[model samples]
Target: MNLFTDIRALVIDSLTALQSEGALPEGLDFANVTVEPPRDAAHGDMATNAAMVLAKPAKMKPRDIAEALAAKLLQDLRIEVAEVAGPGFLNMRLAPDLWRGVVGAALEKGRDFGRSSMGQGRKVNVEFVSANPTGPLHVGHTRGAVFGDALAALLDFAGHDVTREYYINDGGAQVDVLARSVFERYREACGLTPDIAEGLYPGNYLVPVGQALKDKVGDSLLDKGEQFWLEEVREFATEKMMDMIRADLASLGVEMDVFFSEKSLYGSGRIEAALEELDAKGLIYEGVLPPPKGKPDEDWEPREQTLFKSTDHGDDVDRPVKKSDGGWTYFAPDIAYHYDKVQRGFDELIDVFGADHGGYVKRMKAAVSALSDGKVPLDIKLCQLVRLFRDGQPFKMSKRAGNFVTLREVVDLVGPDVTRFVMLTRKNDAPLDFDFAKVLEQSKDNPVFYVQYASARIHSVLRKARDAGIAVDDATLKAADLSLLAHEAEMAVVKKLAEWPRLVEIAARTNEPHRVAFYLYELAGEFHALWNRGNDLPELRFLQEGDSSATQAKIALIRSVSIVISAGLGILGVTPAEEMR
Candidate 1:
């Protein structure tokens, strides 16, 4: 029961009635008409731009259209007041019973109160945290993991068949580097003086990988050169690193539906098949790209190579698929991967990347566009860097992760709930400061705490009501005399509850889950405001003394708040606090 959408339909019906009655023109498009909350609460509960948008198309004055529309709307029993504001804007106040119905709907629906069917069951593939399997996931990957997981959850709530995937970057030079680094540790484990090369990984985290390799193959690989052992050790070390990465993600409550390997694309004829599809469309060519803008002549080397005509699909320049050495560039496997996704019949694709990969976005989109032949849409979200601070000072790096803070370190400090909620406190494109001291602080400034506290408070009320021998179960509270909830303070919270379904559609449409976090905070604020108001007025309190009926009515209102909070936190992969310690 989306109140805004329900009311908008009423507005549209009224507009059609106006046209039928000859009070308005015969034909007018209502697509641009919108029903949303007024900028100022003083105006009304909701505002519509129907008259403003249709006036020009219908060849009528703005005020005349608004006045006529307002009269038509006021005839409906759900609309308590319909006032025409300046320039054909119609502001409306819905009947109190309509707001009361939102509370009942929430109790009836429980966590499903705000779920939407906006996506209409479209298949969506969200690929995120595709970090290299060379080490544990760092803080940047943590943000992407949280963002992508939450986005997948949000899309699922919006009725999309979402597949959470991780693309393993094992078929690259980095995995070879990881093997050499582990070989040094293997040498160390074998009681030899190991040469820790400068370019090889220098983290102590590889000590276990080395010890494991020694345990598996023993001294047989001790005296062998790269040619004798690199392949065997590379596959072994890559699996160990992937094991560590999986544990890191599991610590944060992120689970992928698929773990795709880049190595599979290399030997399976998939890359050639993807390129062949593009070649059939005349998108593949042998050409030389111009020198990059900032390159000096001495450093610029132009060579004819196998390239993809990415410019034809929106990229700024054509991209090379194969270098002059006949080796596939990094972009080649990526194209194959997305092409594989398209072949799987997904209707849409979303990739969550780090801020440093901003330059790679256009080329990737172009590749997917060319591969899918403009059928599937790809949305790439870039998560900026996360700067860690402890006690207002820069936090130290994790020795286990070489030089960066591991996602496990942050989760260990504050647990998964706080970690997940705090990561999404900002948008994906904005830089976030994760302050250990501040996020753990039990105050309003902490959004995770604030939202959780609201849930805890609601539970506390239910427990108190239960102990007092009042029935506060969902079925009972839902059947309460909700008409008793006529107080302005109670209505304010209900109005916020009514906005949840609308907010979910907005967030899903923009592919921004941060909006859900923001809406949860605002809903908590409204709930807390009503909770504070009860201090000055006894009638506003949840447990009204000697009146079980009144208490049930008020408890119903707060129970509705808990329902929405749980749903919102679920989308964020956060566990709502039953009671905040």
Candidate 2:
């Protein structure tokens, strides 16, 4: 049902025929041939570079190859006109019936119209929003959460066995700070003057964690030092923070398939096992790293340490796995985590990180490359910062989150649907401005509203048709006289629908789910364009008075639009509007 793919196949078959007839040379490579929409619609419906790409290899002029290819293509019933343009580009207009067939296909497939099998059932692990469990998730993590969740959904639609994962940063120094922060609150709950240290977390959200701890164990932990209560309180407080994070994610409609604890890598021989694999391959060594580039001599130190030969795998320099104190460095556990993922037999791995982690990407990729022996590919996507604005002014911080706005606060302001859709309105690597006033405005400038309004209008049309006793169910729409949809405006929508399956594969291949949101907005624009035209041209209306055949044909076209929008929004984890209020 991919019209472009089918047409490209036809072009390839015709080229083979030309070779068979001796009109072209044998053994020409057609891999470079491509069929896509013409850059300028005035040129033709679709354009191909088949002749241009094969001219040099075939030892023939491009125009000659194009002329021969055009004649071969016109023989097919699906091709209406195949014309050669500048140099050797072949522009084609498909038969109108072919466009009509796309509408029928959409009606038949419903939400599954654009689903692709391009991933071929590969096992993919997408790890995102691995924020520290010291506090609630902030606006920065919100973007990563939305991006990662949408990417996982997109991969699933593209036929990948995707596992949504969250790597808990519990085995770090940050968790210890969280435990001490809660201990201050615990003392406060016990009617004691607490010392709120400058280094500890200062969020009011920890007030409840402190009260909860006091309720659980009474005052037994009040007078104890870090030695007696640090471990017990660290474990307890980490769980509470994680619980709050889970609830926050649920409020935004994000759910992870796995919540991996980084602490498990310690005391379980996992870190040593991962390093042992590297050691067996001669990737581990005892060496001193050169003074880092761009560093002042006063700030640089030279010391022999246990290092991983990350340069052999593509890192800028060798990385230290153990510190001078003989304890594992921060990079050690990360290597172990990815090694465990590779050992789990995943075919591919993807990590979604913040923009500040740009420097960390090369080292992480090097670790996975060394651990998996280049068998598994790792793709890291970094999401840039989100600047919040309210009424053209900077928004204030959330007191509950200490100094930043929590994800829950954003969700509360505009609900989950708007929040999710607006977060993806920009590319992951680009900075995004989330304006409260503008996003909630009911206008075309708002992509979420524009897309949702299109869905709502389609539903309104269906209801009106049903009330008028015209059968508008998908089964009936599939049986309509689609040939009546011969108008150019109607065909424009069909052409866009034909690109769905292709667009899905492209977005999934590039690991960019924002493209889906962009496509939905374009589809809605095309739909709304046609809807507005109906007011001026009576024949273009979806509900034709006293003409059941024409009304059914028009309704079938719009019903197809709704099907695609629902599927696209579903991939974005946003609920489509049945009716926009």
Cα lDDT of model 2 by residue, 1-581, tens digit: 78899999999999999999999999999999999999999998889999999999999999999999999999999999999998999999999999889899999989999898899999999999999999999999999999999999999999999999999999999999999999999999998987888999999999999999999999999777789999999999999999999999999999999999999999999999999999999999999999867846896778999999999999999999998889999999999999999999999999999999999999999999989889999999999999999999999999888999999999999999999999999999999999999999999999999999999999999999989999999999999999999878888898888888999988999999999999999999999999999989999999999999999999999999999999999999999898988
Residue 114 displacement in candidate 2 (angstroms)? 0.9
Pairs of residues clashing in candidate 1? none
Off by over 4 Å in 2: none
Clashes of each: 0, 0
Task: Please provide TM-scores, in order, for all candidate models, with all chains considered together.
Answer: 0.99, 0.98
Candidate 1 C-alpha lDDT tens digits along 270-356: 999999999999999999888888846887788999999999999999999999999999999999999999999999999999999
Q: Compute the lDDT for candidate 2.
A: 0.95
Instruction: Quantify how close model 2 is to the true structure by its C-alpha RMSD in Å.
Output: 1.1
Which ten residues in a row are the worst by lDDT in model 1? 293-302
